[model samples]
Target: MSEETKQPVMIFHVSSEKGLNEIKKGKLRGVHFFAETCTQYLSLNSSLLNQSDIKEAAKWICSPPVRDKSDSEALWYGIEGKVLDLVSSDHAPYSFDEKGKFFMGNNPSFKEIPNGMPGLHWRLPIILNKVLRKQCNLDLHDFIRITSTMPAKIYGLYPKKGEIRIGSDADITIWNKDKKVILTDEMVVDGSKYNPYSGFELFCWPDEVLLRGHTIVKNNKIMGKQNIGKFLPTKLSDYI
Candidate 1:
């Protein structure tokens, strides 16, 4: 960071108070940084530790550990205060039957299980439905800032990736703020039926997602096949 004049942003698949404090006191230097707390961090807790088999619960495990309710509450406070800046799915799917054996009979130590759950497809809706429903006093613009603009700016994609104005990439998500959907494995494309978010009722969904003049997601489903992505350089020279 001293060499580049850039403070390292932390992207924890799960939130940790200890880690947060470490960053707050570390070599961060007044350099701006953004933390993207994933869905698992915002939603799950550590009680899964008590499962009959730790391995079975392994799939639900993420790094830095899902702390207790106090940690979650602290994270909530951070978000409300603008200390935390972004939320993402961090979505990696592992099959349930594959994870069932670990938790089925023998509880393993916290380190014994595989980690990650599916939600790349449902994160935005889940946030809009659950958090926004509580009337946290955040306007739709706040939503755009955290989920879209801020991250874009930090990553050098700002004014290019996040905006709806002319000359932007035309990538836009049009939300049906009143739409509803029950989150289920059936709704995901990762081919994993095991979602920590299963049984969640999503009240806000995107009805249209456009990518560079092409529509990609419509009616709650992705319209394109996988691997349609092209590589873009993130080097400063590439943008300059």
Candidate 2:
């Protein structure tokens, strides 16, 4: 149908190697399909679930549960080859209490556990470290594409939300590559207090943040006025 009408199909939070292979096959057939994967697929794996500690395993109870290392490498290849159009956090904010992931039981079934954990704050740091360390085989350019530019373009936020050209929103982040951060669960907010990516050591992080030309953050400090955000309507991009 996509090939017939030249319409695009977006597959969200993609995590399977077989699925990506099929998407590649469809692309070869002239299908306009874009796939987006999250940090879990690219940086994390299912091995954490093998632990005897259900408390630890519970942190990874996400939909399309994190897969093996081979699958993760495949997803990275997909991003590098442009077979994947975007990367996302899929930041579902389910708490660890009985009101959320633990609602069904003290040790709930995977079926009963809500499929999400807090990782939004760690997504960039984790990937940046791997990319900089030559672990992911992706350059800084690829990192920016998957994390910012491509996502903005594909989701119709380009020019304004993605790039740094004239007339675009002055949204920019200055990185301090020399700065290092030891990951901890305390860094997360707007969700549970646990971070599945805790213990990761990142060699860089945003030192300054600007939104629409306003300085919002500097060196982990909040300096901007609150509630300045606006909703944006989108046109699914034809970039793919």
Off by over 4 Å in 1: 1-11, 21-32, 53-56, 99-112, 135-137, 225-228, 237-240
What is each predicted model's overall lDDT from 0 to 1?
0.67, 0.83
Q: Supply the global lDDT for candidate 2.
A: 0.83
Indicate which candidate wins on lDDT. 2
TM-score of each: 0.79, 0.92
If candidate 2 were superposed on the true structure by all CA atoms, what would the RMSD be?
Answer: 1.8
> Clashing pairs in model 2?
none
Model 2, span 1-240: residue lDDT tens: 677778777888889899889888988887877889999898889889898877668889888889998999999888888888888888877887788778897876667788887767777777888888888778998988888998787778887777888988888888888788887877765658677788888898889988888999887888989789888877866575
True-vs-predicted CA distance for residue 150, candidate 2, Å: 1.5
lDDT of 1 by residue, 10-117 (tens): 555438776555444442456455566776777778886558764556656766567776776666666666667777787667666545425443555655455666
Worst 10 residues of 2 by lDDT: 187-196
How well does candidate 1 match the true structure in TM-score terms? 0.79
Best candidate according to TM-score: 2
